[model samples]
Target: MAGMVEQVGPPGRDDITAYAAERTGGASVRVGALAPLTRPGWVQAGRHLLAGMELAVSEVNDGGGIAGRPLELVVRDTAADPRRAGAAVEELAGLGVAALAGEYHSVVARAAARAHALGLPFLCSSAVLDALTEEPTDRVARLSPPQSHGWQVYADFLLRAGHERIALATEPSVYWASGAGILREYVAPRGGTVIELDARALTPAGLCDELAGHRASALLLLAGHPEPAVSIVRSVRRDPRLAEVTIGAPAGQPEFAEWATLLGDEGTAIPFLRYLPERLSPLGARVEAALRARLAHPPSFVAFEGYDTIAVLADALRAGGAGRTRPAADWSRVTVEGTRGRIRFSRTPGISVWQWTGAPVQVVDRDPSEPGRFRVLHGG
Candidate 1:
């Protein structure tokens, strides 16, 4: 919303592709988009991410675009596969997109590796994997808080909630393992014990049995959604022994609509991490309204991340297109007025990408009384 581009206009049409198409005419400055639009991916998160990105693209076009060239979004569905994502990055690079933006976690990791190798600037929209690339490089900058930071915040929330005996329902993944390790390390130093449950080997009922036997006060889901997550929640809620146990999802599974659509009332009160400020800036407020109108639902934090990703890239492109964003050597110099706040990137100690350290993080959940609403229980 700052720099050469103007603020987004008021919400009018939900169909942004049609709206963007009607107003723009030029060679077009294309920004390649990544998302898990299909199965094996969190499709709802992808949908929300795309909604925000699409809204930003439309707004960039309406503002006379970059150097009079219309801004364009070339989307590729990552389909939740790492190899598939790597291929997408290679293909997008070949397509001559000015930069890249995204939705998948591991999917983004794979894309990050390839993008880093090719020196393609990638503004990651949602992935939080700590080791996005094998080594440090300037080619990738991230909008989301990393797994270490966000999951540590979640661990603190659990500690404050008097949940000292915690259990993790973990699936096999470097991402999941990293998150669990973060929580364990943060919680253990404060006298909490973390138990790991094999989500792959255990049925929902067996998971519930393990939870009850341990007398664990809290259960954190570090597994995939719908399959084990939904079933685990259901089994735990139905079992009388686990009634008092707290349910958490540090991976943000409950943030999507389908989490509620599948689990319904049982899913309420299960806290998850979301990266949103307690209050939105005026720019964030306007974009939130537009995104809600476009999405026909309250936009998640991931949606805001998508919008901010485009916003940062657009500002860099306007300043100087490829020279500013192609190699991403200027990530430190990129300071754009994003929807959330002023966005800037810097090197973090453990992270490999140019990290936005200021993005807000919160622990929130659907209220049990009103399943449609979210209640902010903790924030950092």
Candidate 2:
């Protein structure tokens, strides 16, 4: 009683650290993981997801563990396929885990429905699809920015850049189409028109000819990947008239530098809401820093989403009493600043409620002033 002694548990548990240490002495807290760990495209995302979860678990164990039980992680590779995701979850559930986390692809999120049905806590790591939270369901919570947040920023960038007539290029895939739909919906009522383009039917040259014929002021490239988008950017650059048009892409990534080089003065990269300077959440930053430090590489937007997923699960576990967080946790006001800003839960189903946040979209004009650096034209 030199200073003060406090009891942290209901009964028989006095010292929190010591109690956790004793409880965790031999037992392991198992967490289920579902991600595409093998594919190169998903390599960074998968690693970052595991890295974040591992860091949180290590930090907890270092802090004397959760109720004295050391956290153990069980990961299953989903290979970025939705069909494989279900099998992976079944494998994890068979392992008898306390909680599950990590998901980069939306299709993988379908597994959460099963996890929810099983009364198991499903922590979303990287699934940005808004539909995940649209329906109110227990045991599933996301720690990443929803796709709608990302789409709003894309639309606003077009409006501010003086883009009047817009064209959309989107694949038939669910995620790509979902984002494209958001962009179209945002543009429709504002006196702006969205022209949908079919990738399969039209070549880059065909799109350029059509844009030239229509005199569209701007174009939004919403394809599934950068491979085709880059070709379109190149095609647009070739036509002197098309070069004057504003070009934007949702979630324009580092690969865009190539397009920037090709378009030269004609290109403009729309800032993704996820990459905005102000969108970085505190927990997201911590998770990002930890993963990058360990992997020796910067985490991409998708990778950051993966990291956010793990952090959310850890928080839920810590907030809930030892081994009591499955299906339900005391996360009513719990806020985790993920890579996309403050992520908070809502009562809605299939859509995890999040704070409204935006970032300045940079319009890069290769200049005599900066040479390589692209200057900010709209939101900075």
Global lDDT of each candidate? 0.82, 0.60
Q: What is the C-alpha lDDT profile of model 1 across 117-202, one tens digit per residue?
A: 77678888888888888788887888998889888899999999999999999999888888888888998889999999999999
Which whole-number lDDT from 0 to 100 does residue 204 have in model 1?
Answer: 86
TM-score of each: 0.92, 0.75
Query: Per-residue lDDT tens digits of candidate 2, residues 274-333?
Result: 443434557667767876787676555555555555455556666784353344354565
Candidate 2's C-alpha lDDT? 0.60
**Which clashing pairs does model 1 show?**
none
Best by TM-score: 1
Misplaced by over 4 Å in model 2 are: 1-24, 38-42, 255-270, 275-289, 301-304, 321-328, 333-344, 348-380
In candidate 1, position 211 carries an lDDT of 92
RMSD of 2: 8.2
